[model samples]
Target: MLKWLRPLVLLLLIGLLGIFGLRWTQQNMRNAIPSANSRVSPIILVPGSSATQERFDAMVNELNNKTKTTSSLLKVTVHTDNHLSYSGTFEPGRSHPYIVIAFENNDDGYSNIKKQAAWFNHAMTILSTRYHFNHFSAIGHSNGGLVLTRYLEKYFNQQKMRINTLMTIASPYNFSETNIDKRTQMLTDLIHDNKKIPSNLVMYSVAGTENYNNDGTVPFASVEAGKYIFQKQAKNYTQITVTGEDTTHHDLPQNGEIVSLIQQYVLHISDTKQRPDVNVRH
Candidate 1:
């Protein structure tokens, strides 16, 4: 009689439950993963030796003055104990947040740079996990650039988070050695690991020159030696020697011309002025 109808009803009920269960699981999964629009693309900056997370405050203020909207600044310090301390907040709906990472042991030297790179990797891992960003831009000044180079060579994984652009300001790739022929141990190591740098990366190596041959701190040849590391590996390696007021090694970070370059290249702002001496290396 109606026995066949009961069996059909039971099958329909079971099918409905399975469909609902699947939808619930999918909804939860979607909730767990951050959407593309919700994710931030921060410009992570590493300061030079003896500098702290507050190193870029003045520069950032100037950057914000040029922008229509003000960006959030987040400073993070990685301690020797592997702990992290943070200051500042990320404003909602802001895609281009500025993040500065400074190490507790912010000293100069090859060994310290290596340690800084390792610390940077750890900090970046935590940052990526917390913020859910899949891409970022990088800027490093002086020894900070060396740390970033080491990190890229050893720890950076493109599959995890893509590096959009890299700008190294007044970085002494040859470490105070003015002669390009006399490469330092650090330079040699960096060149040897050049292949590890992302092929599609657009890198800008900035050399600040107060005089014709040097930046007052880093020699012109020392900074120019970045060509050996990035020229073949990167998609576009540009060597820009910025000469004007405040072109010294430390002041280069806050130079007006450098600010313009950052706006044009790193921030992707249009109609920015470029200096005449900007050289593009193949």
Candidate 2:
């Protein structure tokens, strides 16, 4: 009886040690990872074809130049050679930072857009690990919007991070077609793949009109085609048409009114209330 009791006590002590060791290991691992408060939620931007990460510099300047509070800017370019180059730094403790991602082969065409989507995913994996964010907002201009849409459908992993809002500026979802009745192959594919888009996302599609029917580069009909892709899929979808002196396709990104729209819709500002007197068409 004494021998049996001594063996039982030894086994109990070993089990206790194992339990405490696991607890300690778990605690240390949790401590190593940054808490949600410590992590930053970023607004990521992607430029159109032929534009680099610096494409948004003027817009960022316009954003920071205002009397309103400013967030830091960080530019990251993923080269075709499988290396990343970064510029700028995040403002300390800034919960909403701006991160612009551009590719080395920023070419036009559908095939290239697909490759950019893949590259965008690779860049995101590294960025997510570095920033430790569980969510983000996205802004894409022109072809960049297509890239983001493709990424969301094919490569985005919601288990890692969620996308809350997506704003597409002057994206020709149907390419240069002026009639929504005529859908391009790209638009058809995007429509078919719409189910993969997150249902809780809030989407804003902004179309710039330099004339009655177009933004001087992309047709208004082409931009409006985004409705087919996001209207029913996203939780909330709003289409805004900005018409003014600088509402051209290239100028839309830096347009003063567009900048204000970004501040009101995209950023984590103190005042997010909508103005009653906005002149833009909805």
Candidate 3:
């Protein structure tokens, strides 16, 4: 009876530790950067792997606070819906220059690559018709990046729609054949078979170097080389490096350098038509 009780207590302790660790990580990861208070544009915040709309509130708030300049050129509104639904008017006066953010957890068992693409297409159509936003941009993290890429390959290739820029943070664009997930496989095939899903979208990828082995969740090769694959396939592409003290995949979004890099990218997109070049070494 004493031995059995000890084992039970150890198991309970381990479970508690696991739960606490997960919660701590999540708390650290949950953040938002609000569009700077100016005359910029409205942005739609998309979640990453296992992420919900609530997680992006911090980053949105930060973005809103930091982009305020005398020029008053950067005003942003945040739309937070997991299903990509928009409420109210999306007209020029109402909503323009929308930024779609894709995160990993949003792709659950029920939500696949194709479904996400359809949702994005629907959202783009509604915004384009109602708000006249011909040029749209997307920012995705991890698997969320994959979702956006897949969407571009499948739906936006033929349409006259314009994807101004695509920014991916620590995204896994490449995968090993032996350890490929179903969803990843689908995305890889779509990217490889460019003829099947041609696109002219500009892409930007960011990764770290210290943790070349694994950034907690994604390996270095997956994050760095993945963008190269897109560059090889597309005409316009660039990659940036943001090294953090943590250097873990989970910490990239929260790191100061990464946050600044992302803000600059967003600002560039808001101001001009051309994609800005960025390179953050170390």
Candidate 4:
């Protein structure tokens, strides 16, 4: 009986020690890599004016396929919606290295920028507040680029929202009719203003030239306007021109070659190849 008691006591002590060791190992791992819930910067994908949500879907899938990650393209169908707005999992979170939110406005994020920006404002504010996102990366195409510019003018550098990098694909910043408004004026003004906007922001203005020297939609100059607008801060400015094939203004989001350039700028892929058409003046 005494022999049995001693063995049982030894077994109990070993079990307790195993539990303690396991806990210690978990704590050490937690301290090293940080937790899964640790905050990460979000990438916001905005479609061009009058563009459909489906337009970005293939691109999103492509990004996932290329990176071998499960990063999701979160859809906010309505600007007024909040965290409860969309439903989906992190898709096993196995490949998800970061978060991507693709914003789709009911009004198509065009027609009227001031109003469209309002939707971006409401949605981003709620997301930042809810998720505690401190920094962001922005990508916009066509008039969607204008929306990002407006969003920065309103929210960036504020206590709530901040952006690190901005990419505008075939954006017509020189569109004649938009400058009459005060907000548009402010966007350009802020860029050139001496008060100084955030020094951390790096902007890429990407243009496309098709068969006829035009992007089949937006003129080459219109896309290049960003270089001038952000000229004073040249270090923060980059102008990229993707020419050839179906690399039209509308085809930019889907073009693999151009998307690789985007990967070079944003995702920082391993590709050593660089296209001559891309005039990266960073």
Q: Best lDDT goes to which candidate?
A: 1
Residue 84, candidate 2: alpha-carbon lDDT = 88
Put down candidate 1 lDDT per residue, 157-247, tens digits, no spaces: 8656678899999999999998899999999999999898988789999999998899888999999999999997999999998998999
Model 3 over residues 1-282: C-alpha lDDT tens digits?
997999999999999999999899777555311112233244444445676434444554455455443111121222334344332333345223334444323554324645665666666566555544445566766666766776776676433455556677777766422233433555457656565333455667877656546666776666665643576666567788776585676666656666566567654623235666667767
Which residue pairs in candidate 2 have backbone atoms (N, alpha carbon, C) closer than 3 angstroms, thus clashing? none
TM-score of each: 0.82, 0.81, 0.61, 0.68
Ranking, lDDT, top scorer first: 1, 2, 4, 3
Which parts of model 2 are misplaced by more than 4 Å?
A: 1-38, 268-282
Between which residue pairs do clashes occur in model 4?
70-95
Better of 2 and 4 by lDDT: 2
Question: What lDDT does the true structure give each of the candidates?
Answer: 0.88, 0.87, 0.56, 0.64
> Residue 98, candidate 4: how far off, in angstroms?
7.2
Q: Where does model 1 exceed 4 Å of error? A: 1-38, 271-282
Angstrom error at residue 4, model 3: 99
Assess candidate 1 and give its TM-score to the true structure. Answer: 0.82
Better of 1 and 2 by TM-score: 1
In terms of TM-score, how similar is model 3 to the real structure?
0.61
lDDT (Cα, tens digit) per residue for candidate 4, span 1-282: 997999999999999999999999988875442223325566777777667555567776777677666675666544434333554433323432333334444343234676666677766777666656666677888877877776676555444445667888888776533333323453465355523335557888888888544588777765666665566652488888777776977878878876776676776664565666867777
